[model samples]
Target chain A: MIVFEDVSHDYGGGPLFRDVSVRLEQGSFHFLTGPSGAGKSTFLKLCYGELLPSSGKVTLLNRDLREMTRDQLAETRERIGVVHQDCQFLDHLTVEQNVGLPLTATDRPLRESDVSDLLGWVGLGARADALPPTLSGGERQRAALARAIIGAPNVLLADEPTGNLDWEMSQRLMMLLIELNRMGTAVLIATHDLNLIRFAKAQVQARVMRISGRKLQLAGAEL
Target chain B: MSARAISSLVVPGRGQSVWLVTLSSAAMAFLAVFALALSVTSARLAATWSDALAQTATVRISAPPEEMDSQTALVLDVLRTTPGIAEARVMVPEEQAALLEAWLGPDLPLDALPLPRLIELTETAEGPDRQGLRLRLAAEAPAAVYDDHTRWRRPLVQAATRLQSFALVSLVLIGAVTAAMIALAASAALSSNGQVIRVLRLVGARDRFIALAFVRRISRRALYGSAAGTAVAMLALLALPQAGSAVPVLAGLGFQGWTWALPLTIPPLTAILAWAASMATAFRVLRGVT
Candidate 1:
């Protein structure tokens, strides 16, 4: 679970957002939407302790983000999966190796069968031996998702995960996230795609929050 | 995959830094072997000089030809009664001529020259009291001067000792330079692989895991490079001219007996140094990230 109370953030040019408060409870699904450069990515970063709130406290998994040591932050991150917009990967590594990193990086036992199964589920089973440079954008996003959830994290935070995908590919990726959410993994996704939000709303009980006028507010019932 | 396998995969190994660390370690290790050889050789030389001169003395009698025989007899009598003197004898004219042959040439007419009478003395382990013997010789025959070889031994030993110190200081400087080069290479490698580090961190990889990746690669390269360097240096040393060479120091420049094993330690020591330098740099650079 992640909680932000009376949080305000600034980048040395006035506040981007002020007096914002929100709590993500256990096994809940949520969507964050805003226009370009409206602090959607920054909001996701704050959720994962990548940045500290400028004016208020940010708590991750019941521990104060500011109080965690570098080591402790790493340990906390092991339980939280994060998918980025760029779908970062060690380009030299094979897709299977990249996907298995979450387990291997933490020194956890990795069963090859599990990795293969995850790859199959992400539609990348045939591309497992291919390097990142050879993969298409949709394949890269799927590989990133596979990597994020391979650790069986308790919470998943994704920033514009489907930004580079086509409509069909985006739907497929969103369905994978919905399946993960159904299995009791808290999911918070930040995006500007209203169509994706509407599509996700039909399948799960997802609360939608919008960032506007430098504040976070629940979307109207019309959404 | 094992942890080690994972670590290797996380960091890309292709870069100029790799070759940089390997070549620098090899070059430094080559120098280290020579420095080690010099240190061990000088120490042995110092000991040899000290021991060879320690238990001996010479008595030189310079007097008018008429009194030379009588004064030599008096000096011999004094030496015979000395408690710690094991043996003493007057040098035969032929022996005196042989000693001067190096400087005076082989065909010099020794019989026509006015040469001093020399007596060589060998002492027991607990040698004679030098001061007491000098006073006795001065009293019995003022022209007979007792030389304990201390003047010759002291300066030779001091020079060898200083040579050994210089060699040791050279070894220290080599290690320092090796560490510095490895650190610079590690920093460059880390900076070049910044995106790799970011990806690893995002997946919950700890700094220790990331550091181990670079440390293991760099240290292994150092080990391999230094091993090759040591092998080449050892072969080079074995090819050097041995005893009876024109240069006295060169005669004993290489290792002797059990000391042949000393140069073998250089490669491992360099690897450890590389491990420490790269590990420190990895952690410092990682701290700058999230």
Candidate 2:
């Protein structure tokens, strides 16, 4: 689980986001929505220890982000899988290798058969041998999702996981995210797509949190 | 980390700096082997040439052919009475001829030229007092001058000693150059793979884990390069012919049976140098970025 307490971040010019506290509990599905440049990606980065908060505290898996050593941060990352908006990957490697990267980093010896099964579950079994640049946008999103969950992390943070996909492909990716949440993995997805949030809410009992006026606020039922 | 995990960390043979580490390591190894060879040869030459030239004092009695015999006899008599003069005797014509045979032709007649009569003096445990012996010879055989061979031989020994020092310095410089080159290469590789490293860090790869990939990649290539250099150096050393050579410098180029193993240390030493360079560079760069 990850907890944020009055965390504020500034990118030199001024504070892009301010004093906002939130907690992501276990086995919960939440969707983070905000306008462009609303610090949604930055917030996700704070949860994963990629960037330190300007003030206040952020804790991941009970360890304070400000105090965690590099090794401890790495260990926390092993427990938290993240899907970037851009679906970053080592382009030279095959899709299977990219997906297995999480397991490799954690020294978790995953069998090839199990890796194949995971790819199949993500509908990427046939694209295993292809490189990231060669894959379609939808396939890349699925590949990123598969890679994020390969280590079976306790929490998953997805930043615009379906941003580049069509409605059909987005629905397919949402179904995969819903299935992961059902299996007791805490999921928080930050997106600007309102329809995507409504679609996801219908599939799973999901709470929606929106970033407004530089603070996190739970949306009302009317939103 | 498991071998599989470590192997997965690097894209095999994909780094652009691979050639830099390999070539630098090879260059360092080759220089190291030559340095070792030079040091060994210097030690042997210093011991042999220094000791040979140390305990020798020759008294050359130069005069007219008629007076040469009397002066030589008097110089020998004076040297025998002097303390620390172990055994003083007139050098044979053939021995004197042998000394000048290379500069002067072998067939040159010693009697025709007005050459000096040389008295070879071997020293006791405590060598003769030069000033006292010189005074006695001046009174008895004033034409005679004592030559200890120290002027020419001391420089030879000193030169060899200096050469040994130079070789040691060269070996150290080679290690430093290799480290510097590898560090530059490691930094370049890190900068180029910034995205890959970010992905790796996000997926739970520690700095040490990321560093291990670069270290092993650079070091393994260095090991191969150093091995090749050692093989080439061994062949080069063996190619220098030492058969029946009168020149001590040429003869000393090749090492003895067991001493030949000295050059073998270069490859492993270079491997360690590469490991250290890459590891340090990786950690420093990682700290800067992550």
Candidate 3:
């Protein structure tokens, strides 16, 4: 549902990537890997309309990112879930409140049962009332994931979702992403974890793309 | 979203403590009322000054006491003959003494002092020929000096006008400061709850929706504060000693009749100010977050 046509992004100094074209189709699983300072986060930001392409076009759901109004982008964001690497959460809010924040902000109907059930799914049910700052790194990541998917978005973009977690915690988080992919939510995750990629290769048919020479190059089936 | 959603989102001073909001509002309300009183009082003072001095003209004659009586008689005769001149009366010794007593205190011995005999003049709906009257009095009695009270009256009116202008300026400045303070507080609250805003934005919440959450909170707080302030101010104004019938200046300082309605609007005005300030700050902050 997201297409980047010759999209070149720059942070005012120089191009982050040049004339990179890619299409993320529905119900597909893709993993983007690159070394540190390879602009992985910036690329994901472009997909969500958080950062506009410096040149060319990035379109989401057939609408140009450059042409959509802020309101329209917000609406589009509801259809695309994003789990940030840092797991942004309001420190003052409890885990439940932080997860339910999207519902409150959008004036959506929220039920206590629905919140408990979602927390249960993410294994954060016991920590529902705990404040975000008091939670462990893995718990915080799960909470962020719960918040991202609470709106039932069709597309999920995770930027280093397991960056702060241990191997076991990362496996749990990756399994959740796989489950979402199985449920027909198009998933694109950016990371530098080769072990995680190898782990995913054993579970499903997934494509691997690497950032090389300032362009996205699709790695062969060896990945 | 419906008003119910807005109410839930705002929670009326929940971001801050209820007690703090109440205390701030009460203090602001208290201050606002006094500002309103001062503004209304100054406005009334200006109107009274304008009304008292507007249609009236005075004639003064400076002449020797021996020639004063004859000069007064001649001036009276000329005034009677003059077309626009209504009626002129010579001030009696007691009346002039009482006039001087108002300034010099009641104990002043007017008879011992060589005070000039003053003649009080009145004009009709159509005022008299001020220039012609002065010329006539000068020619008939060279010592006769026509004092039309313009010198003192002009300055008095100007001072009242300046007071009124100053009061209005103060009201505007107070409103601006209040708005700025509320906006700063809102920005801090929003930034502190940055993740909350981001989640809201991610969930399809429009900027206006986000802004309304803060706007409603500030507006309600401001309303409460200004209302309480206005009421206290009104009570303080009532407690103030009325300038007795003898002291018109003091009497002129308090709100009367329809003027009392003016202070009633201060609360709503403050609420509107808070809404505008919060909305602007919220939108600007949201723009940065996105």
Candidate 4:
């Protein structure tokens, strides 16, 4: 679980967000909706310990963000899966190798069958040997998801996971995320699409938070 | 897994190309062996040449031609009785002519030339005191002047000393150059694989683990390269045609006895150099990353 208690972040000389706080517990689904440049990606980066908060407490598990050593932060990242908007993949690697990257990075043992199983689960089995440069947008998203979940992490963070997907493909991805939430993983999806959030609300008990004027607030009952 | 075994897994092509390490190792080994040979030869030459030159004295009796033989006899008698004067053999005309022929070539007629009657006085250690003998000879034979070979001995000893120092300096420069080249190569390889590093770090890999891969590869390559160079160098030195009995200088230029063991140290030295350079670059790059 990730907890942000009065956490503040900034860039250069000015503050991006101040005294912002929220707790993400297990088995919960939350959507972070913000206008352009509202620090949604920065917040996701904070969740993964990639960026440090300028002031106040941002705790992932039991460790404070500012105090964790580089090694310790890397260990923390293993338990928290992050999906970038661009889904950064080593273009030289095949889709299967890209999906199994988490295991390789951790020096974990993997059977040949585990790769095929993971690829099939993400619906990328047939494209396993294909390179990342050859994959379509939705396929790349799912590949990124498989890589994130390969370590069986406790928390999942996606920054615009469906940004480039069509409505049907985005819906399919949302269903997959809902299934993961049902399996007890905390999921936080950051996006700008209010319509997507409204649509997701019909199928699950999800809360929507909007960032405006550099403040985070739960959307009104209508949202 | 042990670092060595793990490292062997990553070298692009190892063991298959015998000449890969061979060329560098042979060149380094050859240079190292020559360095050792030069040092030893110059050292021994200085000691032996100085000892021989230091022991003898030459008396130039500049008396009239009528008094030259008497003065020479008087100087010889004085030397015989002096302490530390083992023996003083006056050079015969033929012997003096042979010595002069070395410089003037055989064409100079030594008998026709009024070369002063040179009396070579060979001294012994404990035979005669050099200073006391010189004073006594001057009194007994006023025109007899003693030259104890010190004029030539000092310069010869100094020249040998300089040669030895030059050999040692060359060895040091070679080692320093080798170390610097290896460091640059390691840095280039580190930069080339920078993306691989970022990927590994993102996946939770420690810096030490990542550095081990590079350190192991480079050190092993250096060791192998140095070994081949050393072998070829040794073989080349052995294959050189032996100089015939005439020139003792060439005889003094080779390694002898246990001195051959010196070149064997070069490969390990190269390995240590590569190891230090690779580790330093790895740490610097890792610091930049985190």
Best-performing candidate as measured by lDDT: 1
**Candidate order (DockQ):** 1, 2, 3, 4
**Evaluation by DockQ, superior candidate among 1 and 3:** 1
User: What lDDT would each prediction earn against the true structure?
Assistant: 0.91, 0.85, 0.77, 0.76
Query: Model 3: per-residue lDDT, tens digit, B1-290?
Result: 33345434533335663334345556666666666667777667667666676655545556666776787777778778877766677778888887788789998877787666566666667777778877887787665677766786778878877776777777777777777777877787677667667766765678887778766776777788778877887888777767566655556456788978878888888788878887898899988877
What i-RMS does each candidate reach, in Å? 0.8, 2.5, 3.8, 4.5
Candidate 1 docks with a DockQ of 0.80
Clashes of each: 0, 0, 10, 13
Per-residue alpha-carbon lDDT of candidate 3 for residues A1-223, written as tens digits (9 for 90 to 100): 8999998878767888889999998888999988777788889999888898989899997889999989889878878888898887767657887777666666677776878898998889999989888998888888988888887778898888887778987887788788878888888889888889889878877899888778998988776
For all predicted structures, in order, the TM-scores are 0.96, 0.88, 0.77, 0.73
Q: Write the per-residue lDDT of candidate 1 for residues B141-218, one digit (tens) a residue.
A: 999999999999999999999999999999999999999999999999999999988888788889999999999999
Which of the two, 1 or 2, has more lDDT?
1
lDDT of 2 by residue, B149-214 (tens): 989898999999999899889989888898899899889888888987888898898898888877
Question: Candidate 2 at B159: error in angstroms?
Answer: 1.2
Instruction: Point out the higher-scoring one by TM-score: 1 or 2.
Output: 1
RMSD of each: 1.6, 3.2, 4.9, 5.6
TM, chain A, every candidate: 0.96, 0.95, 0.94, 0.93
B99: Cα error in model 2, Å: 1.9
lDDT of 4 at A84: 83
Docking class of 2: medium
The prediction achieving the highest TM-score against the true structure is 1
Over the stretch A138-206, how does candidate 4's per-residue lDDT look in tens digits?
889888888887777778999888887788868877887888888888889998877788888888889
Error of 3 at A26 (Å): 1.6
lDDT score, residue B185, model 4? 63
